[model samples]
Target: MTGTTRYLPPGRLSRAINRVVAALTRRGLSLWGSRILSVAGRTTGIMRSTPVNVLAFDDEQYLVAARGNTQWVRNLRAVGRGKLAVGRREQWFTAVEVLDDTRLPVLRAYLRRWSWEVGAFFDGVTADASDDELRAAADKHPVFRIVPTSTPEDRG
Candidate 1:
């Protein structure tokens, strides 16, 4: 969980693209369920924002990092909570890391939806992969279910 997870750092092009997507999403334009995820830094406690794709399954919303154990994922783990914003709407939620065995459905659904954008980070594992394969990849990619809370960040 510490040194084993794979992380794909965004390059200049990806950063620029993320900036655009984050800006648009902040203004209420969600491109294919995209949202700006804001979480506090693990050490600095400063807020960091990044674009993420939300997966909805079984009446619950989830945040899955295609790139394993990313900064946002680590930060959220440290803080235990985060905010998801789309346009002017902000929703605060508690994040609970899904265990390896329970992550298959969400991981599979996420790939099926956003694989074109993040498939490369999964080491060739697509939505079509077998459940065992997805489960194997779960250790690298962390999945968190977003449990909405009536917190200060909530704008609804």
Candidate 2:
């Protein structure tokens, strides 16, 4: 569970849930701090979007790829920026990857907040897992600090 290359593709249920979540966020609803994450596709250059949970910790926001190196994670790493949208509001931001060594706290906090939804991907790791355990699981999950570059703007 400590490899950056690991990725567990979404199952049918997961995919369906993502679509519903994205739709909800687009309609001005947030299901547990969810938002629509839009990023230019590394290959197509067209914006591809998916639903994501925004983790607020230590007064900063972070995006953690709990399912491992999924498409959106790879795209964000390649582009280094993207837009987060909730209904008509869009915020542009640049992302910086968090190194594996420093991910313990964020990983623990994120798990504490999202374990019900994303826990399977982390195997048996939990919010109360030892620092070493969480650290070992960190590399399998890519984390990015969201540095917003634009004020939230009205889409209209």
Clashes of each: 2, 0
C-alpha lDDT of residue 68 in model 1: 79
TM-score of 2: 0.92
| Stretches > 4 Å off in candidate 1 | 1-3, 152-156
- Measured with C-alpha atoms, the lDDT of residue 11 in candidate 1 is 89
Put down candidate 1 lDDT per residue, 1-156, tens digits, no spaces.
434568888889889999999889989999999999999899998899999999989899999887777899889988989889998898888988888577888999999899889988889999999988887788888889999999576512
- Per-model TM-score on C-alpha atoms: 0.92, 0.92
Query: What would you estimate as the lDDT of candidate 2?
Result: 0.89
Least accurate 10 contiguous residues by lDDT in model 2: 147-156
lDDT of each: 0.87, 0.89
Deviation in angstroms for 43 in model 1? 1.2
